[model samples]
Target chain A: MHEASIAASLIEIVIDTAEKNKAEKVTKVFVKIGRLAAIEIDSLEFAYDAIKEEYEIIKDSEIIIEDVPITGKCQKCGVTDTYEEMFFACGACGAFEVELLTGEELTITEIEVD
Target chain B: MGMVDVKAKILEKNYSKAAVLRDKFKNTCVLNFVSSPGSGKTSILEKVLVMFKDKYKLAVVEGDQQTTNDADRIEATGVTAYQVNTGRACHLEATDVEKAMAELGYDLDLLIIENVGNLVCPSQFDLGEDAKVIVLSTTEGDDKPIKYPVMFRVGSSFIINKTDLLPYVEFDVDKCIGYAKGVNPELEVFQASCKTGEGLEEIAAYIEGMIAKKKNA
Candidate 1:
C-alpha cells in the first residue's frame, strides 16, 4: 500500500528532526491526516510501526495520528459545513461552488524526543 | 523527553522532486493519465496519441506492476515509450518519473505518464504533471467519481470512456458528471469511445491547447 511509502517519508522527516536536535531517542511522532487524503489509519500505523524498527532512534517511538474531517465553505451562501461524502454541494445554497477548508492535510506536526 | 516542532508535509520530499520536474518541464505539457485497471487508459493512448505523434514530439512513460506490454503497444504507434515496472508498488512516484525522463529526455511537446492502474494511490503521488486526466469507462459504475473522490477532486479533466457501450449498460452520464462536479465543479468533461473513434478530436484539441499554452508561456 502507499501507506508504507508515506510512512517511510514520515520516518525520514522524524529522523531528520531528531538528528538536527541531537536527540538520543524519539518517543512519539504526531501527525495530522485529513479524511480527503484517502489514507487508512490502521495501515499507516502498521506501516509506521514496521518501518520504525529499521532505525535505532525511533525504534520504540509511537505514531499519534489526528484524523481531520472534511469541511468546506459554500462559495455562494458563505455557509460552512462538514462533508461526510466527497460531494461538496453547498448545504444552504445547493450550489456546487464550495471551497474546501480542510480534509487534505498530511503533515507531521511535532515529535517527542529525548 | 522534549517536544520538537516539525510541521512538515509527509510527502515533502516527493513534492520537492515534483517541483524540480515541473520547472524542467516548462516547455513540455505533461499529462498524468490515471484510472482503475482495464479502464482503457492504454487503449485511449493508443488511439488518441497517434493523432498527435506525427504533428508534435510526444512520448509516454507507462507504469505497471509488471510487463512492458503497454510500452510496446505505444511504441507500435510510432511514438516513443518507456516502461517502468514497479514490481510491488501500486503507484508511480516522482522518482520513477525522473528515471523515465532520463531515458525519454526532456525535449518534447508532450509527455503522458500512464500511471499504474489504481485509482487510490496515484492521486497522492504527483509526477510533475501539468494536469491529471482521469479516465472512467462506462463499464465501471458511474458513481466511481464519488467512490474515488480524491482522484476526481484532483483531476483537471474527466474522460468517460467506452461510451460505445452506453446503449448496453446502465451508466448514467449526467448523474456521473453531476457527482464529479459536486466534488470538483471545474472538471472539463469529455465522452469518448475508442471503438468508434468518437470524441477523439476534442481530446486532441485539448492536448493541443495545453501544448500551445506551455510553448507560449
Candidate 2:
C-alpha cells in the first residue's frame, strides 16, 4: 500500500536522472535498500510495474534491488559488525548499547539507459 | 543499453525539500509525534496546548485521513492548527508539512505536527521535525518498540501514555523503556497520563528547553 508511494518517488528520480543524461530509454535502475529501511522489495516492484507505463522512457525498465545488511558498532566494547537478526546486539560483547552504522539507506546508485 | 552512474538518494526530492524546511526551522523547535490509532495523540496535544498557550506562540499541523475535528479541537484552545487531509495517503510527507507551514506562516515559537496514526508508514517519511516522538499506550503491549522497530529507532523520544490505567493493565514500565532504549540508545522516555495531568509539566518544560536551546544556538 505505502510501497506505491515509494515506487512513485523512485520513478520520479529515475526519470529525472534519465532526462538529465539525455537518454532515450531507461533499461534498468539500480537501487540500494537497507534492512531497516522498512521497504518491501516485491511490493515496490509491483508498484513500479503498474506505474512505469505512464513514463515512456522507463516503460520497460527493470528495477534491481540490492539489500544492504545491518551494520552497527557496540558502545560497550567498540566492536563493529553486521547482524542478520533484528536483535542488533554486539556479537562480541552481547550488549544492546550499539549505534547503527548503516543499513538505513534507500538510494539509487546507477541507471541503465540507451 | 548504456549505464549511467547517477548515484543519488531515491527520495532526493523529499530529502531536499526536508532540508529546506529544516533550515527554515533552524531557530524554531518542531516536534512530530507518531502513534497507533486512539493512542491519545490529539488528547495529549490538547493538554499541551493548554499548558503552553500563554507562554509561547504554538502552531499545530494535524494530519488525518478526513475531517477537521482535530484542528477544530486545537482551534478551541485559541491556537492556530492546520488540518491536512491526506485522503488515501497513509502518512504525512515533508511536502505536506511544507504546505501546512506556508498556510500557518513562519513566525512560531514551537510547531508540532501530529502525524497520521499508523506506525509503519509514517516512520518512512521525514517531515523535517527537530525530533520525532513516539507515543505508546500501556494497553498496546511493551513489545511494540521491538515489533515496530523503525518507528522506535527513528524517534528521539518515547511517551508512555495512559499511565492512569497502569493498575488495570499488565504493562511493565521497565521493560517498555528498556526495549525502546535498545532500539534507540539516546531515546528520552516520559510517562504521562493526560487525564490526571501527570507528567504534562515535565513534557512542557522539556519542549520549552528545546525551543530555548535552538533559539540561543
- Give TM per candidate: 0.99, 0.96
Residue B209, candidate 1: Cα error in Å is: 0.9
lDDT of 2 by residue, B1-217 (tens): 7889977877788888889999999877899989998899988888877877888878999999999999999899888899999999999999999999888887888999999998888988888888998999989998898888888888988999999999999999999888787777788989999999988888888888888987998
Alpha carbon deviation, residue A91, candidate 1 (Å): 1.0
Model 1: TM-score, first chain: 0.98
TM-score of chain B of each: 0.99, 0.97
Docking class of 2: medium
lDDT of 2 by residue, A21-89 (tens): 999999999999888888888988899899999999999999999988999999899999997765666
Taken over the whole model, the C-alpha lDDT of each candidate is 0.95, 0.89
Error of 2 at A81 (Å): 2.5
Candidate 1's displacement at residue B43, Å, is 0.8
Candidate 1's residue-wise lDDT over A2-102, tens digit each? 99999999999999999999999999999999999979999999999998889999999999999999999988989999999889888888999889899
Find the 10 residues in a row with the least total lDDT in model 2 chain A: A82-91
Q: In lDDT terms, which candidate is top?
A: 1
